[model samples]
Each structure stands twice: as C-alpha cells, then as structure tokens.
Target: MRFNKELKNIKIYEAGKPIELVVREFGIDEKDIVKLASNENPYGTSPKVVEAVKLVVDKMSLYPDDSMFELKKGLSNKFKVKSENIIIGAGSDQILEFACRAVLNDNTKVLMNKITFAMYEIYALQQGAKVLKTRCYRHDLDEFYDIYKKASPDIVFICSPNNPTGDALGKEYIYTFLEKVKEPLVIVDGAYMEYAGYKDEKKRVEPKDLIDKFENVLYLGTFSKAYGLGGLRVGYGIANEEIIKNLYKLRPPFNITTLSLKAAVEALKDEDFVNDSVKRNFTQMERYVNFAIQRGFEYIDSYTNFITYIFPKEVSSKELSNRLLQRGIIVRDLTGYGMNALRITIGTKEQNDKFFEKFKEVLNGY
Candidate 1:
C-alpha cells in the first residue's frame, strides 16, 4: 500500500539512545552505562505511584476508561480548572499532535522558535503547514511578534523552559504576544514546568495563571518529567472548554493505559515526592552551572532538570560524548539540535558526582 506524500516526508524524531541499545551497539555492560540523555528523574517514580501501578496491573486485561473521568478530575483539582477543560493523552506529545490535527490544515501557517522542541517542527510538517522558525534567544517575544504579524499563523508553539536550551519566556512577553496575536492559537508546552524555579520571581511565568485571560492559549503538561513516570507515558492538556472539546473530537479512545492513569493520579497526590524531585533538580542544576563556570564552558542559565553547555571549540561535542560513553557516562550530543553542545540530565547525588568526575577527566584529556 502506498502512503500519503506527507507521511513519506515525515521524519521520525531521534531520541537519546537507551542504555540497552547503547550497550548492544558498543559491547558495554548495562551497569556501566550512565544515561544522562533523556531528561528523566534519575531517582525513579515515587513509591505512591509505584504502588498504584502495581495495584492496577491486576486488571490489565480490561481496557482503560476512555473518558478518563478520574484522571481529569484529579487534574482539575490540581490545576484549578474545570474537568471539561482537560484532555488526557498517552503523553504530552500526543496532545501536541492532537492540537496540530484539530487546528492546522493544509495552507495553515505555523510559527515557533528555531531551537524549540523538534517535535513541533515534525508535527507542523506532517500537517502540511507553512512553518516559520525564528532565531533562538531567551524570551525573544519581539521576534516572534514580528513573525506572527507577517505570517498570521494558525498555531504558535512556545516551550517554557524550552527544550535543548532550558530557558523560559517571561510573563510580560507572553501577555504582550497574547495581546498582539489574536488570530493564532498559542500553545505553551510546559512539560518541564514542575522543575521551573522561582515561581514568584519576576522572570518566571506560569501558563496556568494566564489560562483564564487568554481563550486561545493551551497549556500542555506531563507526568514524565518531575513525576518520573516517563515509562508510563501519561500527560495532559489544559485549555478552554471549546478547545478541549475540539481536541477530544480527534483524540482516540483509551489513548492512555489504565495503569498509567492510575499511577499519574497517585503521582499528583505525592506532594513530598514532587517537592523532593524539584529540590534535587534545583540543587543539581546549580552545581552543574558552577562546574561549567569554573571550566569556562558557555551555557544558558537553565530552569529545568537538564543543562545544555557548549563544548570547547577545540573539542567536538560528538567526540566528547563518545569519550564519556567509553568511560560509562552517557550525555546527549546535540548536533541534531543545530548546536555543538551536550545536554546532561540531573541524576541522583551519587550519579551526579560520578558524571562530574568523568566530565572533568574528559576535559583533562583522559
């Protein structure tokens, strides 16, 4: 059977290689690999979520609640939005695709930053939308406004604590953009929001606060990051009831597993666990930033669990990553993200220490 031309042109996203895959490819042992690639909580899921999953596994033969009533209710209580305004998906990634499908059609223009999440570009391409990508900078809303004024895109994706770069846009910029762009749908991808530091600080902006003010804004969140439920793949989207209704129209039934939904519900209740994860992330990020400073490596100030830094010009990121791998440390080589940089996920204290030791050795030409 022949596939559609759009499907043919769709490029699959390349995630960081899994430990098993790397071990198989390089003939290394599993225990030796340090995977700091995916921005996962190195300390796994909370005991509460783990227990919930274990309880739900007994009913694995049954299908999940397609309506996702309980999960939606939990999210509603947590976010202070009505249950009708929430849409659950396998992951926030699915919700992103749903937004693309619900709003974008052929000839629809889309605008996003040049170095934002790669998935946004992929989705835009699949939807046959005209995608305009601007240069990367911290909260450069003026550039986006200029593009929006010209393109009048049907959709705009903004990732707070943006992926690969790990910087966030300010609320004032968002409010200004919202005021200016009335024609487009603004999507705030906050997959890393739980790790966003200084909730009361001047620079930080929480999309949840702006939800009531902007009818066109959609906030996407996930349990995969701070909750350490990446393997379960549960995420959610919060928007106005109208937008949620349109998204639900295109979303498939039972897109999320019963176990995942149950686990995510419990994950939300585990406030202690979430707080610990956030605290650890903040501490580790600060440590890493200091390390980078002492080593004279250029890096953006990060507000998320992962830190991205430019390797010295004399040393290639790919080469450095390869060397790290040989020494049982794994970090992301961001060549595909159009930079000679490496992104290291913050792990447990011991893991962070081990990684830094290896990193220092690598810098010293070990």
Candidate 2:
C-alpha cells in the first residue's frame, strides 16, 4: 500500500500535557497544577450548557443531526445570517481542514503570517499544498499585500488577535486587503474574537459582514473560547452561501455530536453568559498586562484571553516553561512558534494570581 508523501513530513501539534500527566511525571498532586495552557476558559461550561448536556446524555444511542439544523438555526439567529450561509463542524479546526480539502489541490499554495495558528500549515501539508509563510509578527498588512500581489495562493489564513502574539490587525487593514485581493479565498479565523474587546467600537469589524461584499471570504468562529465549550468540540463558519455549499461537500455525515448540538443550542441562547465571560476575561487580562508592565516584563498589549511575554534575555523559553511546570503551572512555550516567548492563558482571578506569583518567583531565581 502506498501512503501519501505529504503525510510523512507533517509535524503534529504538541498540545499541553494534561494535568494528570504532568502530575504523574513530576510527582505533584493534580490539585496543585494550575493549567494556564490551551487558552481554555477556567470557568468551565455555562450552567445552561451543563444542564442541556445532562438532558441529552440519555439519548447518546441516537445519531446527531448530520445537518446540525437546530444549531445552525440558533447561529443564524445570533449572527443574523441565513442558515444556509453557515457550516457547522466538530470544531473550527475541522472546518479549516474541510476548507483545505474542498479548495486546495497539489498545485495550490496556502498563505499565512509567520506566527499564525499551527493548524493552517498542518492542514495544508496534509492536503499536499505548498505553504508560503510571510514574515510578519502581527499580521503586517503591507507584507500581506506584497505577497498577495506577487503570488495568488488558493487560500489565505488570517487569525485576528493572532495566536502567540495576541495582537489584532486593524479593520482598515483587513478592508484594504479585501479590496486588493480578489482571487484567493480568505479565511478570517475569529476563534478568539469574543475576548478581543472591540465589539462595540467603530473600528470593530466582524468578518461575517464581508460575506456579501466578498465572495471568497470565510469567517470561522468557535463555541470553545467564550462559550466555555472547548470539550464539546463545536464551531462554525460563515461565508457566502455558494462557498458554504462547496465546503459542505467535504463534511461527513453526523460530523457534530448530539450532545454538542444540544449544548451549543442552549449556550447560544444564554447571551448573559457570553457577555460575562468576555467581561471577566478582559478584566483578568488587564490585570496580568498591568502586572507584567510594572514588573518590567516585555510583552505586547493583548486583545485576547492569553498574553505572550518574552522572558529575560538569559532565560530560554523552554527553561522558563520547565520551571513553571515544576511549580505546577502549565504555560505554553512558544519555541515551536519560532519565537523565544511564553504564552500564558488568562485563568480565573485566583488562578491568574497563583500563576503570577510563581512566574515572579521563577524570574527572581533566574
């Protein structure tokens, strides 16, 4: 049997080790581990979603709605877009993979910023697509413009409040790019948009608004972050109905689980929960940012739930991360992202405080 050559070269994503795994490895108690990794909501799933999931658990024997009818209807009502324009998935990660499979061929090249999500490159390689990585830390629009002008790729992935960097590209820059790039499909990955703190401002631009204006633009959103449904693995994409129709061709039957659909439907209905999560996340992030600055730490002003901070020149990110682990604090080391930085997810107030205390102790010892 012959295997695809692309599969051999693909590097797997190294997710943060589970608390139990870390505890076993370090001989630490599980309760002691403060996981500030994976950017998960420390508050856990909403009460409404928990109730919904419990209600649906008895129906596990039944297959889920392959079309995700109720979930799509809820999302449609929430976003004020037609149900046909939305495509539900196990997670936005799966939606991204479906997009790659639907649109990319061996001849296709995928374009993304230097420090964007790792999944983009993984999915591209899996589909035997060549990836053109542009050099930009914070989605530099000029660099993107130049690359778009030179080589028109099959797809361009843009992550606002980008992973690892925690910086967002301005709305003007995105609009300008949309105006210039007419050929390739543009994916605006807004997985962390709820934590982005720009919803009410005039400068805020929801990529969904561009669907009617730009045929090739796709907006990816997830229930994982603000909705506290990361464990449920549910997300969606918004696009022109035509593009959504094409993407749906790649989706498998019963792609979303039954409980996930139920929980997501209920979660979407709880507007107050979404608002509260965003508000709390913003407050926690603000405190961390202020603490980092007052302590003379070098970091970017972040719009997302996580903050990426550069360790002191002498301390490698790996060493710092290991020390953090020994203290039972799991923060992400960005060595894989090609930068000597550490990405710490904003946790609950108590969790964040514990992490800060440990972080400061680690710095002092160094």
The most accurate candidate by lDDT is 2
lDDT of 2 by residue, 1-366 (tens): 999899999998998778987888899888888998888888887897898789889999999888788888988887788999999989999999999999888898989999889999999999899998887677887788788788888899989868878888777778888888889999998888876744434335575577867888999999988898888899999999888999898889988888988999999989788888778887888887798779777897777778898767677999989999999999999988888899999899999888988988998897
lDDT of 1: 0.84
lDDT of 1 by residue, 15-120 (tens): 8878988787788888767889999988898997888788879889899888788888888887788898889988899999999998887879888888878899
TM-scores for candidates 1 onward, in order: 0.96, 0.97
Least well predicted 10-residue stretch by lDDT in candidate 1: 197-206
lDDT, candidate 1, residue 296?
86
Clash count per candidate: 0, 0
Instruction: Assess candidate 2 and give its lDDT.
Output: 0.86
Per-candidate Cα RMSD to the true structure, in Å, reads 1.6, 1.4
